[model samples]
Target: MKKAIFLMVLALVFLTPQLSVHADGPDQMIIINKVNNQLYYFDDGTLIRQFPVATGKEDTPTPEGAFTLANKIKNRPWYKENIPGGAANNPLGKRWLGLKVGHNRGHMYGIHGNIRESSIGKYVTNGCIRMHNNDVYWLFNQVAVGTPVIVTRFQGNVEEFAARSGYHVMTWDGEMVDEFQIGRVETLRPMKLYSYNEKGEPIAMQWVPANTRYQVYATDGKGTYTVGSNKYLLYTTPNDTKYELVPSYIKR
Candidate 1:
């Protein structure tokens, strides 16, 4: 639980200026789900606010990941397209909690207010997380930058659910590579490994946390390929390169 808290703290601390540098901000937490069309706010496990929300269409379902507040824009334009400034008729009612995930082109995903209160609790938007205009207005005023924004499957064992990822290391040049695939768990969280060198001698052993970053290198030229995170089977080149799991390089 301390590690989980540390990870959350790391997420909050690394989330950029939206939270850290803000002035006169309250320490609040946000929970949003497109699956349930609900938005929740809490302070230290005490529910402080709750509201109905609208979600993305089935075809354009909102992505599932951990994100943080990137920025806040009030009364902003809906998108480029000369789409008229956000106002009474605008879909982005009053606030946009820009997501920490990268957007293609100029696309943006936000926890924004919507003009269509009637559409609350239903799938209605392109891909943004939506809330009732009044509720968003309230959120806009309350949520501070750096507040943790978890956009995930909305339900299920969020803590247990693991992402499909894998990694392999080269001993000679000491290069590590990560491979990501869909619907695989062999490379899921809580990784454990033991590494040996060319003489079949144990060099090092370690455990890796999911979504954490790490790396390793061999000072000796004769390293060996050891075990790998589940799904991936490693093969070395003819040059006697070694591979093994290293704590350095696993990342979120």
Candidate 2:
């Protein structure tokens, strides 16, 4: 009875704060609506801001997955043939928030503004999430580097990707996705209905993989997942030559 009382007290001590936060809570979260083509910002359960956006087309669509604000560029030029000369019709407007999506296709995908406000809510661009010129400028002011930026079309659950070391980069239709990063992973590891850390530590054994059109997840807690040519690295060198050496997991 004494041991049972001690365990009960310990559970209450840890769980009390969690329950309190969930109840009278104000979530500090941001939301992106793919159907409405709008980005909504929230602080403490209240809607703070919203912005019009543009998404992908039918084919070669903008991938829907959780991402992060990798880097922010000021006064960047639009890459493609959106505009000819200077900043007149530049699709990227004045700011660029580079999003590191599951597909590590670089800044080829991000949240920026276009000169054409009429195309703000339509299916335009190769596979980028576009916003209005002024709206993006405001958003640039709101978020900082490394802020979470989930880009999805389904239910909005933001599952974070593991570290670069834990991710085994593989090309799917020429875009990158994370698999279990263990060396000698022969088969595609069965999606274990649980959550893992960047170092493959099991967090919640009851966790399930969140569904996004282009989402990623770790399969198991073993050192046998596949990467580029094998199950060790994320990307490979030219002609299946070598793998990139990523750093080991950094525990906080």
Candidate 3:
């Protein structure tokens, strides 16, 4: 009895309450549409994948707003049901990405794995979002703490929805989204700088030394990469066989 009581207390601590919480460079983001029961994942503002999920029922509706993934837990035990972590009967499946919903320390509300695959794409839960165990496993491996998560029922494209949420980055009609630095772009040949205008049109700005690198701020999604608020460079491939382009940094 004492052991059971201790377990219950521990579980209570882990499920204490709710709270709320930005996007950063080349970061991972999660946006869930409560209206459609879908979870969209993005990397650097690019939609990577989406999965069907289950939100809370009417009485225990999932908290809808902007939040951050404050923590991650693996094989979390379902102590309320007396199920051990990693057990077949564990309702939390094998992973948990807890959200900082408002004021609390991201302990209570979360996106977790559900053993019941049929529960996905349906309204069923206390307040958490339910995903397939496999799906959650994949997401858990890709995302990290401090990742931004947006939960809303807004009607718009995911990118636009994220933009309206206030912390994400997205371009409007091929325009540069922001001044945040993407990375450094090296000039493969003699290069010159151009001014990036509000329309994303490149205008001859100034002259810079050839065979030099510059800190890239943004891109127009065509071939034009920006260097500053206005300065940018037109990246192009050369037919020269002497040198080939290769990434200075590779990300998994």
Residue by residue across 187-223, what tens digits does model 2's lDDT show?
2222333335799754434322322122222223332
lDDT per residue for candidate 1 within 28-115, as digits (tens), equals 4465655567776644323466687777888987755556677888877865555666657777876777776655321377888877
- Lowest summed lDDT over 10 consecutive residues: which window, candidate 2? 1-10
For model 3, residues 1-252, the per-residue Cα lDDT tens digits are 000000011112223223222524226668898878999886654567789999999999998766788889998888788899889888888898999877876668889998799999999999999999889999998887877777767555565554434323443322333435455555655655776688987677766655665556665555566565535565544421112222211111
TM-score of every candidate relative to the true structure: 0.50, 0.47, 0.58
Best by lDDT: 3
Clashing pairs in 2: 26-44, 169-234, 182-225, 185-224, 226-231, 227-230, 227-231
Quick one: how many clashes does candidate 2 have? 7
User: What stretches of model 2 exceed 4 Å from their correct place?
Assistant: 1-28, 44-46, 81-86, 103-106, 154-252
RMSD of each: 15.6, 19.9, 14.5
Sort order, lDDT high to low = 3, 1, 2
Report the Cα lDDT for candidate 1: 0.50
Best by TM-score: 3
lDDT pick, better of 1 and 3: 3
lDDT of each: 0.50, 0.48, 0.66
